[model samples]
Target chain A: MTTVLIVDDQPLQRYGFRMLLDSVPGTEVVGEAAHGAEAVRMAAQMRPDVVLMDVRMPGMDGIEATRRIVAAGDRSRVLVLTTFDIDEYVYAALRAGASGFLLKDARPEELLAGIRAVAAGDAVIAPTLTRRLLQEFARLVPPAADGSAQDSRLASLTEREREILVAIGKGWSNSEIAGHFVLAESTVKTHVGRVLSKIEARDRIQAVIFAYDHGLARPHAG
Target chain B: MTTVLIVDDQPLQRYGFRMLLDSVPGTEVVGEAAHGAEAVRMAAQMRPDVVLMDVRMPGMDGIEATRRIVAAGDRSRVLVLTTFDIDEYVYAALRAGASGFLLKDARPEELLAGIRAVAAGDAVIAPTLTRRLLQEFARLVPPAADGSAQDSRLASLTEREREILVAIGKGWSNSEIAGHFVLAESTVKTHVGRVLSKIEARDRIQAVIFAYDHGLARPHAG
Candidate 1:
C-alpha cells in the first residue's frame, strides 16, 4: 500500500483529503500535519511514500518543507497542492525538488493518479499549469551550444553510439532507431545499453536530458 | 463544429484519421495534405480550426510547417503527432509554436480531447512527456536575478501591487492573498488585475512568468 502524509493548516482540508485517501484501495493516510515544521518532522519519522503538501502553510511554507524533505533524501516525494491554478510557489517548489503539484480541487482520481505516479518515482503536474510551464521552459532554456569538443561525458561514445544517443534524445524507441538505422531491434537495444552505461545515465529519460545538456539534441528553429 | 486538416504522407494513415474524425461528432475533416508544403499551403487557404500534423513528412517537415503556419498568424493550431513518446522534433515543434502534440497511438478519445483543448486556445502535451519536460524546464530556467533595480517593468508596479505580483508568482489565489494580508478578496483581485495591467501581462500565468523573468520570483535553494 502507498502511504501518505497530509500537510495543511486547515483541519477541514486535511480531514477531507484523509477521507478520500482512506476510501481508496492501496493508499493509506500515515500522518497529518498542521504546518510545515510538523509536516517535515512527521515525514522524517513516518517516511511515507507521498507527502501531500499544502503550499501556503504556517511557519515554514510547503516549498521550504519540500526542499528539506527531498534533501533529507528519504523515500518521500512531495506532491504540492495549491488553491490557484497559476500559483507562483509551484515553480519554486518544483525547482526545490518537489516531485509534482496539483490543484487542491483536482478530481479525487487525478489526485490518486498523481500520488501513484509520484510514489512510483515519476513526476506529475496539474494539466492546467503545464502549457505555461512548457512555454516558460522553452524560453528559459537557451539553445544548446556545441559541446562535443568540450564536454567529456560525450567523449566515451562511439560515432554509432553517439548517433544512438541522439536518437534516444529524440525520444525514439529501440525499434524506431533500428528502423531508422537499418539495425535489428536487439542491436539497437545493445547500443542503447552501452550508451547509457558510458554516459552514466540510469535510464533513457536522464540520457535524453544529458543529450539536451550536451547539445547532442538541439531544438531546431522551425 | 471544430474543422480539422490532416497532414500525413501515408495515405492509409490519412484515411484512418479521416474515418475516425468523421465518425466523431462536433468535428469535421475540412481538408487533407500529403506533404509539409501542401500542409502549409492548405492551412493558409482553408484556415481549419486545428491541423493534425505528422512530424516525419518529406519535403517540408511538420516542424517547419508548424513554424510557417504560426508565423502566418492564422487561427489554426497545429497538434503534432509522433510515433514515439519523446520525439526530439516535438520540442522543436513546441518552440515552433504548435499548440500541442500527442503520440500517434493515443486513444481516439484523447486525440479528440486534445483537438478541443487546442481549438479552445489552450496548449496540450502528452502526459508522459510532461515530467521530463518540467524537470528539464526547471533545470534550464535560471533562478530570478533580483531585477527590481534595473527592469522598467518593476518600475511601473506600486509597492503593494509589486507584493501582489510576487504573491501571484507564488501561485496564491485572491482569497489566499487576502487571508495573508488581511484584505478583502475582491480588493486582492483588483490589485492583481492592476498588477497584470501595470506590467502588461495578459493574465496571471503571464504575470507569474514575468515575475520569474524579472527576478521578482526567486527560487530558494532547498
Candidate 2:
C-alpha cells in the first residue's frame, strides 16, 4: 500500500481527501497536517510514500514544506495540489522536488493516478505543461556570461560527443539519437559515456541539464 | 471543419491517415505531401488549419520545414507526429513553430484530441512532460557568471522591484506575489512596470526569461 500524508490548512479539505483515499485500494492516509511546519514534522516521522501537499497555508506554505521534506532525505514523494492550474505554487513546488501536482478539482481518478504516478517516480504534470513552463523561463535567462565563447567544458568533447550532448539535452534517448544520427546503439552509448565524463555530468539527466546551462541546447530555438 | 495536410514519406502511412481523417466528422485531409518540401508548398497554398508533419524524411526534415513554415507567417499551425516520444525532434519541432506533437502510436481518440488541441492553439504534449523536459535542461544550465555580483540590468530596480522580478521568474501571478509580499495589487503592478521598464522587457514572459538568464531565479534550488 502507498502511505500518504495529506497536508492542508482546512479540516474539511483534509476530511474530503481522507474519505476519497479510504475508498481506494493499495493506498492509505498515514496522517494529516494543517500547515507546513506540522506537515514537515509528520513527514519525518511517518515516512509516507507520498504527500498530498496544498500550496496555500496559514503559516509556512506548501513550497517550504516540500523543500524541507525533500531536503530531509526521506523517500516520501510530494504531489502538490492547488486550485489554480498554472501558478507559482505549482512551479515552485516542482523546483522544490515535488514529483508533480494536480488541480484541486481534478476528477477522483486523475487525482489517484497522479498520486500513483508520483509514488512510482514519474512526474505528475503532463509533458506539454512542463515544456511551456520551461520555454517561458528559458526566454528570461541571460545569455552565457562568456557571450559567444564556447563553454570550456565542451572543449574536451569530440564532435560526435558534442552532438550527442545536444540530442540528450533535447531529451532524446540513446536509441533515438542513434537512429536519427545513423549511428549504432553501441556507438551512441560510447559517445554518451564520453560526453558525460567530459562534461562532468553524473548521468544522462545531468548531461541534459549541463547542455542547457551552457547554452549548448535550448528549447524552442531556431 | 478543421482542414489538415498530411506530410509523410511513406505512401501507406499517408493513406492510413487519409482514410482515418476522411471518416472523421469535423476533420478533412485537404492534401498530402511525400516530403517536407512538398508539405511546405502545400501548407502555403492550401492554408489548412493544421499540418500533420512527420519528423523524419529525405532531403529537408520536418524541423526545417516547420521553421520555414512558421517563419513564413502563415495561419497554418504545424502539428508534428513522431514515432518516438522523448527526442530531439519534438524539442526542435516546438522551437521550429510546430504547435505541439503526438506520438504515432497514440490511440485514435488521443490523436484526434491532440489534433483538436493543436488546431485550437493549445499544446499537444502533457504539461508534466514539458516540466520534466525543462527540469532536465535546467539542471545542465551553467552557474551564473558572477555568482554574487549584482546584474547590471538590475541596478535601477528598487529592492521590492527585484523581489517581484524573482517572484515573476518563479511563475507567480501578480495577486499571488502581492499576497505573499503583503503589498497591494496596485503597488505590485507599479513595481512590475518599473521592473519591466528598467530591464527593457516586452512583457511578463520576457521578464521571467530575463530573470533566469541573469541567474536571478533558478529551476531547482533550496
Candidate 3:
C-alpha cells in the first residue's frame, strides 16, 4: 500500500483528503497534521511515500517546512496541495524541493493521480499552468556577455555536437535525439558524452542549464 | 564606436531607435532590415555587435532566423525587439539563443540599458514575465524511475551529502549552505565534493540538475 499523510490547518479538509485517499487500492492515510511543523515531524517519523501539503501554514509555512524536511533527508515526496494554483508560494515550494503541484479543487482522480505520479517519480504540473510558465520564461533573459560565453565554452563544440546538445537541453534523450537526427543511438551517445566532457558538464541537466545560462537554448520550444 | 543593426519593419520605428541608440556613447546604427531573412544576412555580413530583432516578419520569422544566425556562429548578439512581452515567439527566440528581450515601447533609456546589458553579457528580461515563468516551472516533477538515469545513481551519496545536493539545486553555494547549517565553509565544501563524486556528477551544475530531476530545485528563481 502507498502510505500518505495529509497536512493542513483545517481538520475537516484533512479528513476529506483522507477519505478520498484511503479509498484507493493499496493506499493508506498513515497520519495527519494541522500545521507545517507537525507535517515535517510526521513525515520524518512515518516515512510515508507521499505528503499532501497545504501551501499556507502557521509558523513554518509549507515552503520552509518542505525545505527543512527535505534537508533533513526525509525520503517522502512532498506534493504542494492548495486552493491557489499560480501563487509565488507554489513556485517557492518547488525551490524547496516539492515533488508535485496540485490544486485542491482538482477532481478526485487527478488528486490521487498526482500522489501516484509523484510516488512514481513522474512530475505532475497542472497543464493549464505549463504553457503560461514557459511563455513567461521566454521573457527572462540570461546574463548576457558581449558574446564571449558562446565562443569560449559552447561554440567550441562541433556543429553536429551542438545540435545534440540543444536537443538534450530541450529535454530529449539520446535515443530520441537519434530519431530526430537520423543518427545511430551509439553516435548520439558519443556526441552527448563528448558534450559532457568538452563543456565540462556533468550530465544532461547541466547541459540544459548551460544552454539556458549561456543563451544557447531557450526553455520554450516552438 | 559600438555599431548596431536595427531589424524591424517600420521605418519610423527604426528612425526612432536610431535616434536613441545613436545618442548613447559608443553606439551607432550600421544597418537595418525589414524582414527576418534579410536581418540574418545583414547581421552575418555587417558583423555588428548587436542585432535588434523583431519577432514577427513576413517570411523566415525572427525565431527561425535567429536560429540560423546563431547556428552559423556569428558574432552579433540578437536582442529580440518585440511588441508582445510574453508571446510564444519569445520562447522560440530564447531556444534559438537570442541574447536579450526588449519591449518595443520601453523607455528610450530602458531600451539603451537593454542593449548595453546584453552587449556586456548580462541578460535583461521583463520582471512581470519572470514571475509568471517561475510559477509555470514549479510544476515539473522528476521522473519516478529510470533504470539508468541520475536518480538511481543518487543513492550513493550520504544523507548529509544529499541535503547539500538539494541545497545546490536551489542555487546555494558553499558559504550560504555553511551559514544555513552553522557548519564551516570547509565542511560544506567537503560535503559538496563528496556528493559530487558519489553521484558521479561532473561538477556542481550536474549536481544541481540531478537535484531538479529528482524533484528537488525550482525551475527558475526570481
Candidate 4:
C-alpha cells in the first residue's frame, strides 16, 4: 500500500482528505498533523510515500515545513494543497523542495492522481496558478546572478536539436513545426523524442519550465 | 495610410468603429459593410490593412469572410469582435485567418492596440481567453495523428538540459531552478537565456504553451 500523511491547519480538511484517500485503493492515510512542526515530525515517523500539505499552517508555514520535511531526509514526496490566492508562495514552495502544489478545490480524481504521480517521483502544479508562476519567473529573470558556471546540463544538444527545442518552447505541434522547418513529420518526431530522453524530463510541462528557468526560452510577448 | 474597413450588421457599431479608426493617425476608415458578403466585396475593392468584423452577423458571418479574405491573397488582417458567450467561435476565426479577436466590452485602448498589433503581424490572444484556449488545446490534443510526437519535442536536449527545461516549463524562477540544478545563480541565468534564444521562444508564457502543446508539459496531477 502507498502510505500517506495529511498536513494542514484545519481539522476538517485533514478529515476530508483522510476519508478520500481511504476510499481509494492502494492508498492509506498513515498519519495526520495540524501544523508544520507536527508534520515534520510525523513525516519522519510515518515514512509515508506522499504528504498532502496545506500552505497557511501556523508556526513554520507550509513552505518552512516543506523545507524541513525534504531536508530531514524523509523519503515522503510532498504535494502542496492551496487555494488560488496563494499564488505568491507556490513558486517558493517548489523551491523549498515540495514535489508539487495544487489548488484545494481540485476534483477528487485529480487529487488522488497527483498523490500517485508525485509518489512515483514526478512534480505537479495547478492550472489556475499558471499566471502567478509566470509573473514570478518574469520578476526574477533580469537580475539572474547565477551566470558563469556554464550549465553543463545544456552541453548535450546539437545545433538542429536546439532549433527543435525552441520550437517546442514555442508550443508548435509536430505538423506545424514540420511546416516551419520544412522537414518531414517523422523527422520532427524523432527529434522531439530524442530531446526528451536526452534531458530526462518528467514530461513536456517540465521541459517548458526548464527552458524558462534556464533561459532556454523567453516569455512570448502578446 | 493604413486603410481600414468595418463590417457589422449594426450601423452604430460600424459608425462608432469608423469614427475611432479615423481618429487614429496613419489609419483611415475607407469603407463599411452591413454583412459578411458585402464586407468581402468591399474588402476586395478597398483592400484595407485591417478589417473589424463582427462574429454574429447574418448570412456569411465573419468567419467565412475571414477565410475568403485569406484565400483572396489580400494581406489585410481580420480582427473578430464578440461577446463572452459567443467566444467559442473566436479560435475558429483565428484559423480562418483572423490575426486577433477582441471582446465588444474590451477597453477602448485595447481595441486600438489590437489593431496595431495585428497590422504589425503579431498574434494577439486575449489574456482572458487564455484559459479557454488551453482548454481547447488540451481537448484537441487527443486526436493528434502523431501519437508519440509529444515526447519527441525534447529529443535533442542533453539529460541536464531536459531537467532544466522541465523546471522552466513548471514556471520556476531562476533562483529556484538554480537551487534544483545545484548551479550558481549566474550559471542558471545563462542557461535560461540560452534556452530562450536557442528555442526561439518570444517569452516564458509561450514557452509554457509550447510545453503543453507538445505534451512534454502537462497540468500538474493534484
Candidate 5:
C-alpha cells in the first residue's frame, strides 16, 4: 500500500481527503497536518510515500515544506494541491522539487492517480495547466548556451555518438534510435552508455537536456 | 463538429485513422494526405480544425508539415503521431508549433480526445512523456538573465505591482494573492491587469515566465 500524509490548512479539507483516501484500497492516509511546519515534521517522522500538500498553508506554506522534505533526501514525493487551475505557486512548488500538483477540486480518481504516479517516482501535472507550461517551456527554452557548436564537452563525442546524443535529446528510445540508425539495440545501448559517460550526464533525461543546452539538438524546420 | 485532415505516408495507417475518426461522432474526416507536401497543401486548402500528422513520412516529414501549417496561421492545429513515446521529432514538432503528439498505438478514445483538445486550442502530450518533459523543464530553465534586480521592464512597476508580478510568477491566482496581501479580489485583479499591461505580457502565463526570467519569483527556502 502507498502511504500518504495530508497537509492542508482547513480541518474539514483534511477530513475530506482522509475519508476519501481511507476508502481507497491502495492508498492509506498515514497522517494529517493542518499547516506546513507540521506537515514537514510529520513527513520526516513518517516518511510517507506521498505527501498531499496544500499550497496556501498558513505557517511555512506548502512550497517551502516541499523543498525541505525533498532536500532532506527522504522517500516522500510531494503532490501539492491548489485551489486554482493555473497557479504560480504550483510552478514554484514544482521547481522547489514537489513531484507535481493537482487542483484541490480534482476528481477523486485523478488525485489517486496522481498519488500513484508520484509514489511510483514519476511526475504529474494537472492537465489544465500543462498547455501553458508547455507554451512557456517552448518559449523560455534558450538556444544553446554557446550558439556555436564548439562546447568542449561535445568535443569528446564521436560523430556517431553526437547523432546518438541528438536522438536522445529528441526523446527517442534506444530501440527507436537503433532502428533509425540500423544498429543493433545492444550497440545502441553501448553508444548511449558511452555518450552519457562522455557528456557526464546522469541519465538519458540529462543527456536530452545536455543535447538541447548545446547545439546538438535544435528546433529545426521540417 | 470537429473536422480533421489525416496525414500519414502509409496507406493502411491513413485508412485506420480515417476509419476511427469517421466512426466517431462529433468528428469528420475532411481529407487525407500521403506525405508532408500533400498534407501542407491539403491543410491550406481545407483548413481542417485538426490535422492528424505522422512524423516519419516518406517525403515531406510531419515535423516540417507541422511547422508550415502552424506558420500558415490557419485554424488547423496539428496533432502529430509517432511510433515511439518520447521521440525527438515530437519535440521538434511542438517547437515547430504543432498542438501536441501521441503514440500511434494510443487507444482510439485517446486519439479522439487529443484531437478534441487540439481543436479547442489547448495542447496535449502523452502522459508518459510529461514526466520527462517537466524534469527537463525544471533543469533547463535559466536563472534571471539580468540576475540583478534592475530590469527596466520591471522598473516600470509600482511597488505593489512588482509584488503582484512576483506572485503571478509564483503561479498564485489573483484570489490567492489577495488573500495573502489582505486586499480585495477586485483590487488584486486591477493590480494584475496593470502589471500585465506595464510588463507587456500577453497573459498570466507570460507574466509567470517574465517573473521567473526577471528573478522576481524564486524558489526560496522555507
Candidate 6:
C-alpha cells in the first residue's frame, strides 16, 4: 500500500484528502499535518511513501519543507499540492525535490494516481507541461560559464558512452536504450555506470542533468 | 475547422496521416509535403493551423524546418512527430519553437487530441515525461557568465517586482501570482509588465527562462 502524509493548513482540506485516500485500495493515509514544519517532522517520523504537500503553508511553506525532507534522505517522495497548476509553488516544489504535484481541485482518482506514480519512482507531471515549465526555465539559462571545462570532461567519453548519455538525457529506460542500440542490457548498464563515473554524476538522473547543463544534450529548437 | 499541413518523407506515413486526419471532423488536411524544405515553404504559403511535422526527414530535418516555420512569424503551430518520445529531436523541436510533439506509435485518438491541444495553444507532452526531460536538461545548465550583469537588471526592480519575477520563472500564471501576493490582478499585470521590460524579457516564458538562467530561480537541492 502507498502510505501518504497529507500536509495542508486547512483542516477541511486535510480531512477531505484523508477521507478520499483512506477509501482507496492499495493506499493508506499514514498521517496528516497542518503546516510545512509539522509535515517535515511527521515525514521523518512516519517515513511515509508519499507526502501530499501543500505549497502555501502557514509556518515554513511547502518548498522549504520539501527541501528539508528530501535532504533528510528518506525514501518518501513529495507530491506537492498547489492552488493552480501554473503556480510558482509547483515550480519551487519541483526544484525542492518534489516528485510531482497535483491541483487541489483534481479528482480523487487523479490524486490517487499521482500519489501512486510518485511512489513508483516516476515523475508525475505530464511531458507537455513539464516541457513548458522546463523550457521557460531553460530559456533564462545561459550557456554554463564553465561549459568549456565541463565539455573537456566529456571529451574522455567514447562515442558509444556519449551516445548512452544522450539516451539517458532523453529519459530512455535502460532496456529501451539497449534495444534501440542493439546492445546487451548488461552492456548498457556497464556503459551507464562508466558514464556516471566519468561525468562524476550521482546517478542516471544526474547524468542526464549534466548532459543538458553542459549542452551535450539540448531541447530541440523550433 | 482546423487546417493542417502533413509533412513526412515517407509516402505511406504521409498517406496514413492524411487518411486519419481527413476522416476526423473539424480537422482539414490542407496540404502535404514530402520533405522539410517543402514543408517550410508550404507552412509559409498555406499558413495552416497546425503542421504535423515528421522529425527525421532526409533533406532538411524537422528541427530546422520547425525553426524556420516559427522564425517566419506565421500563426501555424508545429506539432512534431518522432519515432521515440524521448528522442533529443523532440527537445530540439521544442527549442525550435514547435508547440509540442507525439510519438509515431500514438493511438489515433491521442493524435487527434494532441493536434487539438496544440491548435488550442497548449503543449501536448505528458507532464511526467516533461519533468524528467526538463529536469535533466536543467541540471546540466551552468550559471550564466553574464549573470551578474543580467542580475543588475533585476536589481532595478522593487522587492515586489522581484518576487513576481521569481513567480513567473516558476511558471506561475498572472492570476495565480496575483492571488498569491494578495494583490489586485490589475496591479499584478502592471508588475508583470514592468518585470518583463526591466528584465528585457520578450514575454512571460522568456522572463521565466531568464529567472533560471540568471539563478533567480533554482530547483531545490536534496
Model 1: CA > 4 A from native = A143-222, B145-222
User: Fraction of native contacts in model 2?
Assistant: 0.02
Compared with the true structure, the alpha-carbon lDDT of candidate 1 equals 0.81
lDDT of 2 by residue, B1-222 (tens): 999999999999999999888888999999999998898898899899999999889988888888778778887888888887655565566656677777788778767877887787666554335445546543433234222235677778888888899888666778888999999999889999999999998667567667666766554410
- State candidate 1's DockQ: 0.10
DockQ values of all predictions = 0.10, 0.06, 0.05, 0.06, 0.10, 0.08
Best by lDDT: 1
Relative to the unseen true structure, what is the C-alpha lDDT of residue B56 in candidate 3, on a scale of 0 to 100? 76
What TM-score would every model get versus the actual structure? 0.63, 0.60, 0.39, 0.36, 0.64, 0.59
Give the residue spans of candidate 5 off by over 4 A: A143-222, B143-222
True contacts kept of each: 0.20, 0.02, 0.07, 0.09, 0.19, 0.11
Once model 5 is optimally superposed onto the true structure by TM-score, how far is the C-alpha of residue A148 displaced, in angstroms? 15
lDDT of 6 at A191: 96
State in Å the error of residue A117, model 4.
Answer: 31
User: Mind giving the per-residue lDDT tens digits that candidate 6 earns over B127-205?
Assistant: 4455565465435443332211235686798998889988876657778888899999999999999998998876675
Q: Which candidate, 4 or 5, has the higher lDDT?
A: 5
| B37-64 per-residue lDDT for model 5 (tens digits) | 9999999999999999998889878888
lDDT of 3 at B145: 19
Estimate, for each residue in A1-222, the C-alpha lDDT of model 3 and write its tens digit.
Answer: 789988999889998998898777978999998888898889889999888898888887887777777777767888887787654655577667777677888889878867886787655555444333433444344433121224466768999888888787666767789999999999999999999888887767667767655655533211
Q: How do all the candidates rank in terms of lDDT, highest first?
A: 1, 5, 6, 2, 3, 4
Task: State which candidate, 1 or 3, has the greater lDDT.
Answer: 1
The CAPRI-style docking tier of model 5 reads: incorrect
What clash count does candidate 3 reach?
A: 12
Candidate 5's TM-score:
0.64
Taking every candidate in turn, the Cα RMSD to the unseen true structure, in Å, is 17.9, 14.7, 16.1, 18.3, 16.2, 16.5
True-vs-predicted CA distance for residue B24, candidate 5, Å: 2.9
Model 3: docking quality category: incorrect
